[model samples]
Target: MRTVGNDLVRSQLHENRKWYLGLGALLVVFGIVLLAALPFATLTVIYIFGALMMLGGIIHFIAAFKIFEGGYRWFWALFGVLYLIAGYYAFSTPVKTAIVLTNILAIILIIAGVIRIFNALLFRAFQGWGWTLFSGILTLVTGVIILMSPDAPFWVLGLFLAVDILFQGVNYLTLASYIRREVPKSSAEQ
Candidate 1:
């Protein structure tokens, strides 16, 4: 009976540990992908933002035609006007949008790095803490560099984006690997 109980407890503990490790690995993979896609992502985001804005504007203009029908028509009209204005603003000052986007990216990187570091700290009592710590530090440093160079030109920002994406990709891949390796076979199988 004692042996059986011990075995059950050990199995449960192993499964829990594996689950946590798997989560960590997933986070690493996510980070890596984010870093790798950072370069092209900026342009993609800008294009998408512009496209959405334009689409929204067009929709609003179309909806404005129905305003005469009443039933919250004024609200729709107001929204339509705002959407049109926003779309034009985005189109007319793409550079400004780019700048703001860059800043946002930098902040996101920093925040992600900080979160990774915190995760590492939380798991300091556990084995394999070093990986989390290293990833966290790397992310934090990269984020800081980007933030410090806020005035970087569009090309520079593009470079940063690429680097960020690469790093994030690496992080994610590493994390995934760790999870695969560390996760309990039983837990994973389940």
Candidate 2:
């Protein structure tokens, strides 16, 4: 028998199934587009990134003034200003922005990979820790390769991003399905 709390959780998941499915469909569409435009992905990605940055900059700028209190309020404003400038520059020179963003992505991946490896090491007490370590190593290697040749095969980045997005979408859909299946059962039991 399931508890009331379990029924609530299941019901919530069931109610939100449509949202998950919608998100999954959206991501799958994006992945299809990326695959279809594999050849033009390099230039296309530049513009996409530029647009995203500009949009993010606008959001950041708006957020800057919303801080009611804090010593770092101005600091956020300064960063916001920088974001605006960078966004404008990106929109103006998308190719340049692409290269820079790729390099930045590489560096970030490297850092994240190192952190993951360390975390995996600390998780030695847990089972299947080796898988985490292996993934970390793979991530680290990929970062290093990207850092070495950020400009080479730029389209691959788009392809990979698309694939990653699609996978995330599928995961959401699967979770939603599981919730839908289990929720009704739990409620019925209750």
lDDT of each: 0.66, 0.75
lDDT per residue for candidate 2 within 15-102, as digits (tens), equals 6789999998888887788778764666677666667766777676677677535756667677777777776887787667667777
TM-score per model over all chains: 0.47, 0.63
Model number with the top lDDT: 2
Residue 150 error, candidate 1, Å: 4.5
Report RMSD for candidate 2: 4.9
Worst 10 residues of 2 by lDDT: 181-190
lDDT of 1 by residue, 1-190 (tens): 7756655655665546545555556655654554465545555556667778778877876776754557566677777777767667667776777787677777887899899999999999999888998998898887787768745435445555455545655555565555456644443345
Q: 148 in model 2: Cα distance from truth in Å?
A: 2.6
Point out the worst 10-residue segment of candidate 1 by lDDT.
181-190
lDDT of 2: 0.75
